[model samples]
Target: MPFMIGRAPVRRTLKYLESGKIVLKDQIKIFSINYNVGQGFKNKVHEGAQAFVFWTLPQLQYKNPDVQIVTFKNMTPSPFIRCYYEDGKQILIDIDSRSNDEIVNHLIKVIGKSKQVLKAEALAAEEKDNPANFGVGCARKCMCEIPGQIPCPGVCPLPKVMRGKYFYFKKDELENPEL
Candidate 1:
């Protein structure tokens, strides 16, 4: 309940991850960055890529657990980012000479979910958590409504014969065994 105090109730950690502010689109499956650890321009690019990775890696991982992130240092001649999608499609962005902020901003603009998408996701989550709502889209409806399901004892009283009190015999009945 403490976790639900200020925010909408998240049914699971996976759902919570999906509703993050910078969630990746479902199409994207992997993110790979290639940079070099050299002098001058390469060093600047390396610093930028390192900064971007340091700052955004955890967020991306948390937001999209299914997405794989790979970083290659001192392996490529220049810096670039590659995004692999579910349908065997990929998008490569050149980050050869961009600064740290520029790299972050550009990648976010190109790959991260848009503001509207985030808003819609947040609204959907709120609606799902609404106490008044029920059924499939909302918090679970009445359990008793399901076919062949037993109603909760706290919600619906058990039949007299099924109750614990019914098992106890009155003092008179106990004494008069024939009755």
Candidate 2:
């Protein structure tokens, strides 16, 4: 007989953000989805996400198409979903779909992608609207420099990169977070 994992603790954080919210800042805006689901079950999906991080993360550096990366393997413990990535990135994502029927469509997977896409779109839009944001001749020069490890002059000493798995929801979708 196949054993079934009990879904009992899923109710603990009933009033958490599980979808989407965006906040804009002059230096940097954060588009995030917050999920504070079943906070603590360390299980198979969690293990899988870990494995993906270990095996895949090292190989992705300098990879184009997705300089910003996030990978999701599962959702466990009800409220919290499992995402795979390096440590230290601050993030929270929510897709806002009521039913999490399939693992592929889980909050982590969708919202993570949304964060990445929105970031790209924002940069593209900025570049498109303000040509002066670029160099004197529109030559490769831009008002701001790309973020990298070593800080460059006139650049943000620190840059905000999306990190961590967060729940997604529509505006006003989640109630005030239970303190």
Candidate 3:
């Protein structure tokens, strides 16, 4: 019988097992196939257990075109569904004793979520659109020698290309009004 394993704990345990640091024979409980299905055993086995997640590769591929990477983990201590986002954040949802339709609904909700947290802002600052100006420009000959202007040699420092006429100032130059 296959058992759900927690991702991190299982990974570490597997690594230790591979390096012969831990004996699997001594840890029989960890590998036990025995399950406690006392009261609602028949119902759980017939209903919940049979509710296996059925997802097609084509469906996932077509639905999530922007998904560059995807991974699945089965968590124990009552089955849980966990997903990792590109921002190095994880979202875990417990689906223990849930029906197949309910699990699918939860999965749909997870898939539709974007990986951004809500930012709190005052009412006065809520309508403002702040843009960043990092002094990105083309190199050009200046008629007036500005006190803090640094000339670029006919090349963009960012791309290191000679095609554009661009120049930028150092942090010190930008901060200081005088040379």
Using TM-score as the measure, the top candidate is 1
lDDT, model 1: 0.73
TM-score of 3: 0.30
lDDT of 2 by residue, 34-133 (tens): 2322225534334433432333233322222234444433433422332333443444433232333332234334433456666887799866745334
Q: Model 3: per-residue lDDT, tens digit, 30-126?
A: 1111112334644453233233322222233333445533333332335554555555556666656777566555555554432232122334366
Q: What would the per-residue lDDT of candidate 1 be over residues 1-179, giving only the tens digit for each residue?
A: 46665433352345544543456687999999888765684477577776666655556678778999888888887788999999999999998777767876776688888888878988987765755454776555766665677797888888866766656766677567798
2 against 3, candidate with superior lDDT: 3
Candidate no. 1 TM-score? 0.60
Q: Per-prediction RMSD in angstroms?
A: 9.3, 25.8, 18.3
Q: Note the Cα lDDT for every prediction shown.
A: 0.73, 0.36, 0.39
What is the lDDT for 171 in model 2? 34
Model 1 bad stretches (over 4 Å): 1-21, 38-41, 129-179
Report the Cα lDDT for residue 177, model 1: 79
Clashes of 1: 0
